[model samples]
Target: MDNGSFALMQQLEQLYIDHHSWLSSLLRRKLSNSSDAADLAHDVYLNLIRKGGVPSAENCRRHLTQIAKGMVIDLYRRRRLEAIHLEALREQPEPLVPSEEVRALAVEALSHVDAALRNQPSKARQALLMHKLSGMGHRDIAAELKVSVSSVEKYIASGLRACTPYAVKRRPFR
Candidate 1:
């Protein structure tokens, strides 16, 4: 490794030593789940490592906290989506309920879609959700989003393109 990369790694190690517990504690208080707190604490550092820089000492805690907060929000959003999916599944006929693997795959696919399009325009995300989940046509989605029908079509298409990289091939569920 180059000298700069080595120095950054060492700095990150020291930062982890200094801030990991504090980060975990902050997340635990916010999330009220120790396990998830620990997991997200690790994720925070991993994110830093991937970003390839250490924040200055004064800003380190703030940077870590921001990342942790975003992660916490994602965790809550994911749980909410999963709960909604579960409720819908529960309403289905027992015989029609999917296998556990199928259910897991469905949830994983939803997560991929969410993670992929999260940073896209809100109209895009909303249009796609309305079309797929609410079974609304483009005209209704355009009316709801207060955009032109063509704009709604573009939004849905953009959202789909964003998620294309994350798509997995489907297998027959049976």
Candidate 2:
């Protein structure tokens, strides 16, 4: 259609062809895996596709570099989350055969909290959900649940202690 838009697309395409390998090589040196770095470099192009159009070639290189960097940070976050989940799973009583069992454990934990809420009359269960499932801070949960900050802390601590026995226990040391 327009020369400006056409030029922009061409610039991004050429940038991908020229510097994608360079980006992967640099990212691989910094990260643990070359494939992951290549994937991130590829994601930068996919994101531009989603945005309807890429910027002019003059800016596309810089923008691609920025996008690649952000993707690296995102990968780190995902890795951290996976570590936390795996650590938690190791101490739980859930099934180990199927991969879906881990998701089931998360579901069961939420269900236990829900049942406790229905059983309790006051702010305890609500506080538990806010602190555990909703990711609220102690002070924030207290404010939302109309309890003291100390009470919120107590609720979370007690809940965790109460669930520890029910949690998945690790196997004996070899």
Candidate 3:
């Protein structure tokens, strides 16, 4: 690695040595789970390493806290998505139940879709899910969202656009 990168790594290593425990303790209190806190603390450092920057000493705690908070939010969202997927699976008939591999892939895809929708407005996300997942028409979604049909259309379009990057190419089945 170049000198700048090497120096940054050294700084990060020192930072980790200095503050990992404090960060983990802080997260543990917030999450009320030692293991999750530890995992998120590690993720904070990993994210910093990925970004290839060491925060100033005075700002290190703030930076780490921000990363940890975001990670915790993502963890909660992922867990909720997984739980919802599992519940849906439980409702299927045994004969039509997906294989474990398929179930895993489905959950992963759902997480991707959730992540893609994370930044959309709440109404847009709700409208898209109601229309796509519940097979609700635009009028129905508009009624449920208490908006005009044109608004529902715009909301669904906004959600779909947010998810476009995560969309997989599909092939026609034989």
Candidate of highest TM-score:
1
For each candidate, the alpha-carbon lDDT, in order, equals 0.90, 0.70, 0.89
lDDT of 3 by residue, 47-106 (tens): 999998999999989988898889999999899889987999999999878789878877
Off by over 4 Å in 1: 119-155, 165-174
> What tens digits encode model 2's per-residue C-alpha lDDT throughout 1-174?
699778767867777787788777878887878788778878888878677676665776677778788777766755665566667777777555326675566545544544444445457656776777889898898888878999887877766665554465445656
Candidates 2 and 3 compared by lDDT, better number: 3
Clashes of each: 0, 4, 0
Query: Distance (Å) between predicted and true CA of 159, model 3?
Result: 6.5
Error of 3 at 161 (Å): 6.6
In what order do the candidates fall by lDDT, top score first? 1, 3, 2
* Candidate 3 local lDDT, residue 164: 79
What ranges in model 3 sit over 4 Å off?
116-174
Compared to the true structure, candidate 2 yields what TM-score? Answer: 0.51
Q: Top lDDT: which candidate number?
A: 1
Candidate 1 has a TM-score of 0.79
